[model samples]
Target: MTIDAKTPEEYISKVPEDRKEAISKLRETIKTNLPYGFEECINYGMIGYVVPHSLYPDGYHCDPKQPLPFACIASQKNFVALYHSGVYADPKIHDWFVAEYPKYVKTKLDMGKSCIRFKNIQTIPYELIGELCRKMTAQEWINLYEQNIKKS
Candidate 1:
């Protein structure tokens, strides 16, 4: 589904009322942990925190102007998703998350290439989540994600 959100406020407005608080809280958490140079914006139907294409002029992930670095927080019909760049390349972190997350959440965590679909804010392991946020930079994440793409 294409979420036509022009601003973050608009994006939050689109989310169901029950999910808004959790989404907002997660948004705060992500914003607090992001490294320097990353910016939050609306992209591809979700709340995408990105490294603007303008900042990395040489190209994104080795291709000039090709891709941007992003961490997304998305609201779905049934749950919210936290899309972070760390998941694709860091086996240790991925393993930690997979193992520990279920303990905190009531519902299952759904995953995609780099997306973590979760039910609500209460399910998050704040410390580990914060660590994941602090560990990745736009360039580092872009490199890792690119490697995964190549491997796949």
Candidate 2:
């Protein structure tokens, strides 16, 4: 599902009707728990939370024009996905989320480097996602990205 949306609200409006509520809730959860300094916008065609350029002028190493992305939520064709850069960059957070997942959802965890796919939207663990959002602040993400992701 490629949604050509200029804003987060537009993205949400374009998602499948069945997924609107879940995506909205997921967006809300991320927004409510994400630490201060992260701004919400449409990034990479998804609802993205990023560290604004004002905070990190260098921006994303891959694309200096864009802000430093922290997290994103999107409704895909088969599932709704949550992408958290911290989980991919930090082993401790990855291990913690992996161990804690079974406690929340019965379905087997569907995850990639940073993408967590929820095939059953009803099974999406909003609370755990919120906690994950709160795990890293913007400055911390900038530090981690510099050390682990950004190339010299």
TM-score of each: 0.78, 0.98
Per-model root-mean-square deviation over C-alphas? 3.3, 0.6
Instruction: Write one digit per residue (lDDT tens) for candidate 2, span 19-62.
Output: 99999999999999999999999999999999999999999988
lDDT tens per residue, model 1, 95-118? 877887677665777788678877
Per-residue lDDT of 20 in model 1 = 82
Report model 1's TM-score to 2 decimal places: 0.78
Q: Pick the candidate with the highest TM-score.
A: 2
Q: Number of the top candidate by lDDT?
A: 2
- Cα lDDT for residue 11, candidate 1: 90
* Per-model lDDT: 0.73, 0.93
